[model samples]
Target: MNASRRDLLKLGTLAAAGSFLPAAALANAGSGVIEKAAKPLRILILGGTGFTGPFQVNYALARGHKVTLFNRGKRPSPEWPGEVEQLHGDRNTGDLKSLEGREWDVCIDNPTSLPFWVRDAGKVLAGKVGHYLFISTISVYADGSKPGMTEDAKLAEYKGKDAMAETMETLRADIENLYGALKALSEAEAHKQFGDQVTIVRPGYIVGPRDETDRFTYWPKRIAQGGEVLVPGDGLDPVQIIDGRDLGEWMIRLAEKGTRGTFNAVGPDYELTMDSMLHGCHAVTGGKVTFTHFPVADIPEDVGLPIWVPREGTPFSGYGAVSNAKAIAEGLTFRPLATTVTELLTWYRALPAERQAEVRAGIPLDKEAELLKAFHAKQGA
Candidate 1:
């Protein structure tokens, strides 16, 4: 279903990007589209109030499935249906007593990065659940430099003989370095206990509304500001992203049919490039904007840019080129990139001033300005 949008300044962009957005997939949007609805089943979600989790819960409820959320009461979900049951426990500390002996038709593991979280929950949920769906990342892949990599590609490995078990603090300390490797470990734990009943989804660069991190949100925010935006590489570099809502909806369908195995959940529904992504943002923002391009070699390695990894001479050269054919064949559909841009701008503008100022990804405004100056100067020199 298409996410609802607000503050409609310009929608003409949707027409130009229509070719990129498939209308056949969304043929039932805005209308109650769950045909011959499957019998309602109970769905359990770990960390339901978080960014991606809410979308899963939202779509699950919309599809007539009941939801139960497991998390610390620290973040309550007022946006969700009031009738959904919620249980409290801390997964980091391995306190899963709240989930003991409880059963559901399916369980969606949304927040697990550490292996112990899965092992701890599996001990309790082993035969009690029908299917276990774990939300994972494309980061789990060992290499992205090779194009056309599929779901069966090499995965990042963690040594089994290592003496110490990974903890949240340890993962947090070197998150950028260890995240993928650890997610690989966690995926193993899910299957070790559940076997064929486990479904794993590996998404590339999850984006769109309610995204706390500025990773992909930076483009929409920067473009809407209407000025010289500093973008890395020539505008043709490859890029890939999946809206969080799209991924959530697909997972619901998977759970409904008891589909299992791995799928790469990245899309434009077609191949996409850096220029198309930026121009899509500009089209929706309706701004007198200019994108200043910098060569990949010019930007310092530590000055992290969001979403645009260089596709040459780096470990992530093929990052944006990961395949999604399997997922699409299995009914995984994507809304147009224009819909993502429009909905993201609407969501970002709704935030309070303080929260809006707290974007966690992308370069800061001053740093972006400094880089743009040096980029232009080098060209003039």
Candidate 2:
């Protein structure tokens, strides 16, 4: 059955209640509500104009916190409600002078892709910020993790100081392991500088509105076109995504509650499978999508798939599923997958017609049709 936005909102509300309620009341109310604490927080967010930064900005604003943004002032955005201060600086050359004398309750580091950059920033803002939150990725784990790996499992080690030099190019050519290692090193540096004041949020694929890159948008856009859809691999591989807004909310909550430690900020620990993810997209778009599941052996040698592709012998082996119990226990909850997909589609539709064409041109229609046919055939089988 197709899931509606209303249904997804209801699910999110219920999940929030269950996730935020106290343990004693959880049994009777099935709600997750923690005691409210009042300490108006002032936050500074690095990389506030990026894909995930805006959501974080919105979330903090909603919670009645003051926010200061540090960026290069390249991409200007709509003015935010409430008090928002923007500082101009570049982290590459260590020109964070604008933030020299400032102090905030918490600082969310969203753009520290390199260890040196993180180390420099941490050195500058160490004692000034109360809590330093570094947004890391799930890629920090070993290449092939056990089914559901927790935070303390096999972590990637830093190769060297110049490890993140070729991040952009390497990330595209399937060298995310190095990227993760550098980020892991960066997180370690932040903790080293601030100790117990650091909170590391390692998230899976993050999807939501105002997404400049259409990585996750491709699925919803293709499904909304209403035809056969492509199924990579068995269509049973587990897929997890944390909505940008949910990640933002949880980050603010952590700052408010002074939560610490490395938490896996993912979705509900429920029966989520690859097929269910695709199905959720189909339901949200109200499109009839037939999946054509391609066997590992039958995948065309030259067919370039941009997303996850597992190595041989391990169907779910390449990217291991992350456990969110730690984050949930610390008051992390997810906005339903259905809601995320719908909002993603809505944002895509709101784009200019020319921009939409530009995005769709990335994928060849014939290849998409073939994949959809394969996915549908697999569904029937």
- The TM-score values for the models, in the order shown, are 0.88, 0.81
Instruction: Please write out the lDDT profile of model 2 over residues 182-207, one tens digit for every residue.
Output: 76788888888888899999876666
The CA lDDT at 100 in model 1 is: 92
Clashing pairs in 1: none
* Candidate 1 steric clashes: 0
Query: Candidate 1 versus the native: TM-score?
Result: 0.88
Residue 181 displacement in candidate 1 (angstroms) = 1.7
> Once model 1 is optimally superposed onto the true structure by TM-score, how far is the C-alpha of residue 69 displaced, in angstroms?
0.9
Residues 193-219, model 1: lDDT tens digits: 888899999887777776666677888
Prediction-by-prediction clash tally: 0, 18
> By summed lDDT, which 10 consecutive residues of candidate 1 come out lowest?
1-10
Q: Deviation in angstroms for 261 in model 1?
A: 1.0
